[model samples]
Target chain A: MSVRHALLGLLSEGPKYGHQLRQEFEERTGDVWPLNVGQVYTTLQRLERDGLVESDDTASEGTQNVYRITGAGVDELGIWLHTPPDLTSPPRDELVIKVLVALRMPALDVRDVLQVHRRYLVELMQQWTRLKEDEGEFDFALALVVDSELFRLDSVIRWLDAVDGRLKRAEIEPPVAVPELPRLRRRLAVRR
Target chain B: MNVLELREVTKAYGEGMAQVHAIENVSLSVERGALVAIMGPSGSGKSTLLTIAGSLEEPTSGEVFIEGAPLSTMSHNEKARLRRQTLGFVFQDFNLLPGLTAAENVSLPLELDGMKAKKAHTIAMSMLGEFGLGDRASHFPDQLSGGERQRVAIARAVIGNRHLLLADEPSGALDSVNGEAVMRMILNACKQSGVAAVVVTHEAQLASWADRVVFLRDGHVVDQTVPPPTPEQLVHTAQQR
Candidate 1:
């Protein structure tokens, strides 16, 4: 799922510039992995540096730069095609991890994380809505996203209220007591 | 008679102070042509029971029988053979081959079992056509929509006439409308084919689709419904206050 290999794989099909790559990637994957135009260009630059891909920088004015997979890129793409892509080293899902950590942290700011998640869910809902409204028929990729991802987005929206309640309860709860605190503090004070 | 059964199934984790009885003395049955669901909370051991039934994992204790035969007696190859010939699975994730087209995914089991490529593709295409995805049969998994992918998985599962069709949270990934469509398709197809189904779900809506719904507590079947409700009944019950 590396943008690098995806870029190379697309280039192997034919020459494409950054915008073309971005558009093709979205259309192919059904936007399962959102790629920005900037990401496509950056990955193209890296691929060029690695010699896995080549680009003609001297394109005529008003025309986009044309990039194609190199010999090495073809070899790499072939290997990746046969092998299972390593998903273990995927980009960290900070939203999931941060909330999980917040659950562990004593009196953690659950409210803050929920607020952030709420904002993100709101933004995601807008994207899904716009996509739905703009498109008449369902493309398979978009259909999949509309079904599963929208449910996930909605679930997060619903969960924010639950998290807020949990945080409010935590804030109102009494402090924990330690039975041996006074004796332990006296022992430490003597040493100091 | 029970076509499939679980006997005093008890699964426990940890030892000494940490010992947790995940499933305790649980038993259930699935008759021929039945579509049953095992529903429970997160730590309720429904998944463990399912894995044991599917022969993917060994139970801590007790016996699992499919069509009156014991799973414990089977050797690895025997189990594999039985699974290949007699069982079909529909995972919530749809477990489709990413590179393969929908038709190819449906054809995999048949090919693996030594069916001719042309024959298998013919059969697979017919199944996809049944599910209204004939036109998209050539589309890869990534190219298909979520609902389409699930239907493809269902097609793949039932393609070979496997006796038992087991699904784990099959509709967990679908939207309400698409989920309803998948449920109807699965139930109707299984019923018509006379294939026994065991669906695992936490969602009440999906559980209702089962011919009979079984509720789990810890690891045991705590409750069971008789004369399984109709789809209309299920929906009415779901909407009840």
Candidate 2:
């Protein structure tokens, strides 16, 4: 997700100018994520400033200053690739928030709200599937992208089913309220 | 063409006092070259629906069709011949014969359908090779790994250009990674052969590989919808109208 690291990683391949870097990036990712030429150059400049990359003045063509990854850049890329992403904190998911807020409001049928979102997610999944088929027989990069989206949406749909099941059970048998008197009486008996 | 269709099909068991409807008024149609997934919790009639669709079991009342010909119109021999010729089933257990080699197991269905044993074996071996199992062709079922066995089962099911496939939890016994491989093989084979298929699976991830998913609940068709149109479909529809 970090364009900074992506550019640094690309530079590790060898010296590359602005346009070449953009083209290679798109080609490798099956053009699923497009990078702006200006953004690429700006990131390259920042990498040069931070000593992560250096411009090859000798290989420079007209308006095309080639950049190569420094020793430090190789180390940085290595660390980034080996480091595990921080997933301890949950992201701000709109669907989760909506379900929670709906649970508090009795006027809203939470199941109905969940079903609507579930349908939308399924539609998105189908759209991704269609895209994968369109990409043709041997598009590995696109296959990975489609698989990731489909798995994420499938997990969300499973969660909705879980919530629906729990709510249905709660309706059939109202959740029992914990009575405070039993604990107090048990404590007194134990003391006696 | 509709390779398989079930109209208002219902299957109930037992007498009045202990009657249980395994499937109730479930209508489904699968056209050639289509892959439809039937997903539901256990005992929700997923298997029942598949059995009826494949004509392995008859519905208590309702019409079943294969290639637009009503199943009820066929005699017992005719129905049996139809199934042997047009339908193939992949079971959760792999269902390969222990006495036969991988190639023999794959070739058995074709041989039973009256193809020459030598010719059937050759076709089976080639299909196995395509699935990266050519090396295991001579090995018996007990010698093959679980994934290999499942792959062989699939090869057998799709052999002889069978137009329809019914799979009951095809990936059930394999690990997740192997299960995914099996799923991809099924999808690729279906697309390549233009065979219509109905897969009964509890795994949602597997179901996502389907062209459309049909959800069943207590034997009822609770949800059924086709996936968004592919580019080929859009073009085909445009040409039609």
Candidate 3:
């Protein structure tokens, strides 16, 4: 989600100054990711520098400058939208790091740490749930935001449960060490 | 009017040292045209509360009421008849009979209550049509998709003016999209017919569709809240900071 690409995409609609682009971006994304006006202008300047967008000399009455997407900008936007996000390696997740570190500590129960985090995630999910209820017939963008947050939190909770179950099972029997996937037990070899 | 009520409801299993109190003096009421959701972890006694409220089991020492009438005063046959006529249930597995077609499945409850089969089929078809399954009337449960099967189960549950709809993790077997579709159907049923519903689920998102949510833990009602918080608040707070 490059700000430059977002501005180019917005300009694809027509000529839009920095303020208008900021408003449109917030509106379309359900204001989940609000953009600062200064940041918007900075990105627009960079986009103009890169020849992805060009500023118009023809003055529209109330605005300082109107930028339109160039052919190159259109091409760039197309490519960016089509490109799949990289998922080769896991992103740095704070909760995952915390849980892994907690598991190594002798004094703390990893399950208890997982429970604390699970409760927080559940509370966050509840907040999103409340937002959906308040919206009643939710707007498309708002609904998507709420739905994604709920699903993500739900998955995290499920992962916690899986980790807790596996940890308990490992306690009952000595776990086999696997170098690549520490803390995860290796599967037993089956007879053919 | 309150369609369902529980007063000091306590359900216990076994006796003496082995006794486990599934529900402990929990009281709740669902008004006409309202949907209430009960949420808790496993062993939290959510199912016990629903079963006692539905009159499937007698509470050891509490009162259950449906449509302002007390369950304790009713005879066994009266209670059975009440369940058949006034109460309905939707389950996680859908519980549709494989031998019956969609229309037949929806109409079974009405027909069992002594309605003419033709009349029951008519009501069932109309309900099925409302659920967007009119074209699949002749299709058997095995032929329909999971969503369709659940819809049929819901239509059957609320058929013939059965005002109290009790569901236990009704969408537990569905994907998120299908789970939401099921919730919409249930919400529509409550709105269109003024039927009161109580759904027990672990999913808070699904519970958001209800008018009120009751959280239970250790077989006791810990908290109840009307309308949970929304996403806009978080975004606004972040923006402010």
Candidate 4:
């Protein structure tokens, strides 16, 4: 669901500021859609601009900006929640795009992917151990997640080994590394 | 109506076979306009305590008051009506109807109580507006982002304006930004409307949003801290929990 609708929908229970809405969203959904705090305020600003939500005139002293959904927003949200929106084809993710390009880049990219998974598997295993100490059903869920991560990591690691053997048998030099300075710069800028 | 009350309450899940004690001698009170959080780990009996207090599921053995009267001897229908009239729930999952709009989702709780469509929708629309979903109210769940879905869920939960707000991981699916916003909004509503709230959360950051934070581990309140520590402490507590 759209964050905007979620914000407005939540306000239906009562009026709330931006920060409050973000917390409730996570609490209700089990951290399935973690929101950045800045995004919550930004979205609220947009909603207010559209007259979908209105904030109180009071000067709140917290990071949360006080806002409540507007009547128009309710009407619009009502329509959208019931009516099916025009469907767009699923967009390709970076993983798919990267994998497609990896095929022409020799087997090194495959090894890189394997490395990432191996690290992730280790992390998940660590998390699972810590979570079990807390004594909750989260352990059950984490176990499943850890299992999947390990399984994926194992598969990738195996594939990497196979690729290594094939390369050795072929006796071919590995692909030369290419500097991606521009791409790295763009990524760093985007992060900032 | 008193709705629910706990007197030095303690709840344990298993007997000698597999004893998993969920709550330990916890006392809480929920009247009208009372929203509460029973924050704890997965096995913590916060849910158990809530179910018993709400009279949805009985406590292993505790004195639960409903509507100024005792529910200890009430029938199933009596308890059901009590639940319908006094309590509303918001699950971690946004349980909105696929066919329903934002307003429709908000109106469900009231509608279930036999409120008319016109009346319910009117209230629902107002509720949606209150949360800020006005302009794109007609957009379906698919068209909405994660934050929007959560907003819809909150609206639906509060549409009935039930006195007690029992949210289980209310912001579980939201991003930190969205999650914080949701918590603030819930607390504000509870504060402004004087709805006593009990929100169950594993995140101390979220729990800090509450007026009081009673930390629970292994289904027991091991500590109670008012106000909060610095952001570091809150974060540390959350991570440790």
Model 4 steric clash total? 110
Model 2 lDDT per residue over A95-152, tens place: 8778878888879878668757765666666666666656734778766766777788
Q: Please give the DockQ score of every candidate, comma-separated.
A: 0.01, 0.24, 0.27, 0.02
Tell me how large the interface RMSD of candidate 2 is.
6.1
lDDT of 4 at B202: 59
Candidate 4 on A1-192: residue-level lDDT in tens? Answer: 588887888887888867778888876544435787898888888988999988886665754456777889999789879988766444354544554466457646553553354334333333332332232235344334433443554454345445535544445655466433226456657987
Error of 3 at A123 (Å): 7.2
Give the distance in Å from residue B188's predicted Cα in candidate 2 to where it truly belongs: 3.8
Candidates 1 and 2 compared by TM-score, better number = 2
Is model 2 an incorrect, acceptable, medium or high docking prediction?
Answer: acceptable
Query: How accurate locally is residue B184 in candidate 1, as Cα lDDT from 0 to 100?
Result: 69
**i-RMS, every candidate?**
16.0, 6.1, 3.9, 15.4
Q: What does the lDDT come to for candidate 4?
A: 0.64
Worst 10 residues of 1 chain B by lDDT: B229-238
Off by over 4 Å in 3: A11-24, A31-39, A57-66, A70-139, A153-192, B229-241
Return the candidate ranking by lDDT, descending: 3, 2, 1, 4
Tens digits of per-residue lDDT for model 3 on A74-137? 9999999999878745446898889878877879978668766765666666677656555635
